[model samples]
Target: MTSFAQSERAGLCDTFLEVGPDAPTLCSDWRARDLAAHLILRERRPDAAIGMFLAPLAGRTDRIQASLAQRPFEELVDTIRSGPPKWSPMALGSIDEAANFAEFFVHHEDVLRGVDPSARRQLDAAEQKAIFAALPRIGMLSLRSCRVGVVADAGSYGRRSLRSPKDDHGNVVLTGEPGEILLHIFGRTAVTDVELDGADHDVESFRKTDLGT
Candidate 1:
């Protein structure tokens, strides 16, 4: 896992450096540099760190990005590669290592969408596991409206399973590679690409509720 994390981190750093200053990202308002800064911040300050506990009031994303921008690009990448600071307020303890892998995998995809789409192909099983482990916590399924089943392509990173309230009432079989399923559930853009063996409404509603605005 450490080796995989290092590889993913290196890929991410390379992508960040490769993206032009004017490049846009899937994150909408954030530019490529902002995305790079975000990753650096996560490496340095995890949720369990002191800053998170103290300013508990301050928005973590904002704090991290602000800190990242304070340094030059070379310094920022150097800091991330050096690992989290010992005195950071948001360290995740023993799990900090896991968080490192998780952030790299997810953010790598985010920045890659703008810089290099092929970069995602480089993710290995370990990196996928780390990102998958973090998904449920991201609120992909809103129990208030639906039940989701996620299955990944034995080889993809964005797999997920989701059923709408209506689909739960009838017989249906919705299946796809994990990455496609997850992207659809997150209301990203995979729904059109996934195959539905039953009523399409279930997938439609799920997308509408989560991915669709």
Candidate 2:
């Protein structure tokens, strides 16, 4: 079976090429070319990739990404479509599956959903399972700073605590298909359709929380 990672990567690259370099994306201020450069840098430039998590290094990362953005658009698209070079750690099978599945899935949506009057993509069970498998880590990464508790309830698949009640704020249980939950976690809350069950205050806060890019 083709892995979700591989599927999403191909889809994302195709969309990037189809849309061309100047097209808008859901990612704030990023055009198709910019997004392609980002994927390439994250996979190929280990030293610069650290900036993704380090605020101090972000400026340097941005400079490098901008320089890369100036490369021939077709070359950038080809690099993204091909994925990480053989020498990179992400080139390993297991690591690539773990890391790229959600990355490419989210980015694929970023391109597709950015268009006017966008419709949600139809995800298969295997793709949903891939996103769900990464939920614990994604939940912690995106929601750790929020004041509400998050339980990603993937029925029959299992329930995982994304977070505990950070304060007196009520706990919010997010029950939905893994793809919807992934959209919410990635800060596309306004466009996502998921069951948000909790106090109004908590739900509102959760929606407003800066969940990152």
Candidate 3:
């Protein structure tokens, strides 16, 4: 799965290289190149040794992301495919690997949207779940309070929300094949065919929030 994801990430980067300089991306202020630079930077962070020791004080993901955004695209890609950072921990578990996978998958989609819309359909179930699980951990799921039904289908796993939480302000009936819903919620704005309710602005606002936007 990791190998597949890395290949996808590389493919996404190649797609971005073809984007015109004037093209816009989901990241409003960023051009396609800027987004590519950011992804590359993300993969090039200091080893886990330095990260674990100093991350508590200076390892803000946003800061790290911003710092990466400043580099040139080619340099960033070279860093990502290179061997793991020297200080990285040796005993990373499944969850950590999942997190890494999610990072590349989500950002790949984000960049693809701006460069090549067709790239969105390239994702598989394992990649989708890794993205789904990772988004919430990074605060992407906290976009808005809506009483929306959520149905997810990924390979053999399927789940549906039977009851809306009390805090929800409106109802959004999100029912579809699991992978579709996963794609919709995780930065795929083109999934307009999926069911949605409440004010369009609310949904749009949710999309604009810091979670993934």
Best by TM-score: 2
Q: Better model by TM-score, 2 or 3?
A: 2
On lDDT, the leading prediction is: 2
lDDT of each: 0.52, 0.84, 0.50
Q: What value does the lDDT take at residue 157 in candidate 1?
A: 53
Question: How does residue 181 of candidate 1 score in lDDT?
Answer: 38
- List candidate 1 stretches off by more than 4 Å: 45-67, 87-94, 116-187, 190-198, 211-213
Alpha-carbon runs more than 4 Å astray in model 3: 1-4, 18-23, 40-72, 89-96, 116-157, 162-164, 168-171, 176-180, 187-193, 197-213
Task: List, residue by residue over 31-61, the lDDT tens digit for candidate 2.
Answer: 9888988988899998998999999999999
Sorted on TM-score, highest at the top, how do the candidates line up?
Answer: 2, 1, 3
What lDDT does model 2 reach?
0.84
Task: Evaluate residue 94 in candidate 3 and report its C-alpha lDDT on the 0 to 100 scale.
Answer: 52
Lowest lDDT block of 10, candidate 3: 146-155
TM-score of 3: 0.59
Candidate 2 total steric clashes: 0
Backbone clashes in model 3, listed as residue pairs? 47-87, 47-88, 48-87, 48-88, 49-87, 152-178, 153-178
